[model samples]
Target: MRMPAAKKVKSLPPADVEAIFARFHEIEPEPKGELDYVNAFTLLVAVVLSAQATDAGVNKATKRLFQLAPSPAAMAALGVEGIEAEIKTIGLFRNKAKNVFALSQQLLERHGGEVPADRGSLEALPGVGRKTANVVLNIWFKQPTIAVDTHLFRVGNRTGLAVADNPLAVEQILLKVVPERFMLHAHHWLILHGRYICKARRPECWRCPIREWCRYEPKTPAPNGA
Candidate 1:
């Protein structure tokens, strides 16, 4: 589901855009994603499994699985059934298992058992899309790329940050508007804000660090009683 039309806000002024990220940086100089992974391969697998599931859920299933198959060759050897058994707790386990196995084999055969550092090669792997590739590229390779997820889609339009109909458009706008200094951690900051304070259903505007810059109106009230 999408944010309601009633909540959509107009684009924020250029200064407010900068102020918002400045406030984010003031609060968290170094924002981090919730997903846990050891290496680039594990990060890729985690992102793949995290498509429609929560990071906590994916991490729970992959805790043992990653340990069992930390590399492409090891994961390929596990086969689809083995991977499926390990990740069965996640949603769409069957399809995700096949993807993980196939992608692992592809990595072994194509990139010599190393996760490619480029977008084209990474996106070629099974179940790896632009967003997944961008995540791996940004986090693993230190590229200043934005990987827009649902939280981004909502927060972008709802707060007049990017105000776009789709994720890519929002990403592009953010890339242009957000200052270079904050590009590296922009996605993490925005996603975490949307996940926590600037929530989808009931935005806790009273506590939002940058609510002053956000366009979404009718700030949510604090709960009754302390």
Candidate 2:
């Protein structure tokens, strides 16, 4: 069946945007990404494996995998078969295994076994796209970048924080609208908010902290017997 087009989100004014982000910061001063990793290399691997997978799923597999191969050299030594076996539970495991191994090799050969801080260098790695690179840069390197994942895209557009058609546009709009103090943690806040509250199918709007600031009409009511 053909789905209805997404509602055109009305843009929030600067003051409203600031207030919304201010609330996010006040509630969770230092929001963090759910994906678990030890260091930059592990973080890269985790993000790569999280393409069509959940953070909890990636963490579940990587708990042992990271212990087995914590470094690029170690992961390279583990080989594609080993990586595949470890991450087989995740979606696109075969390709993700190939990428993990190949990127590990590249890290050793070109980067001296270190994840590069530069966006171009990070994106050059296998399976590391703009989103992955942005995540690594923001989380590991403390860069104020918005990694426009499904959660962030939905939250940004739905709440009028950013009214964009694509992830890239949403990211760009958020970068401009979000205050500098909140930029570093903005993506995480939005991600967690969307994942738990502003859900795709049925957002729990009744108890939302930022409901007053949201542009989404027809706010969902409390579930029966709640």
Q: How far is 29's C-alpha from truth in model 1 (Å)? A: 1.0
Count of steric clashes across candidates, in order: 0, 0
TM-score computed on alpha carbons, candidate 1:
0.96
Q: How do all models score by TM-score?
A: 0.96, 0.97
Local error of candidate 2 at 110, Å?
0.7
Error of 1 at 123 (Å): 1.1
In candidate 2, which residue ranges exceed 4 Å CA deviation? 1-5
Per-residue lDDT tens digits of candidate 1, residues 1-226?
A: 2434434579998899889999999999988888889999999999999998999999999999999999999999999999999999999999999999999999988899999999999989999998999899999999999988888888898889898877778899999999999999999899998899877778888888888888887878888872
lDDT of 1: 0.90
> Looking at candidate 1, what is the lDDT of residue 23?
93
Pairs with backbone N, CA or C atoms under 3 Å apart (clashes), candidate 2:
none
8-107 in candidate 2: lDDT tens per residue?
Answer: 8789999999999899888999888898999999999999999989999999999999999999999999999999999889999999999999999999
lDDT score, candidate 1, position 120: 97
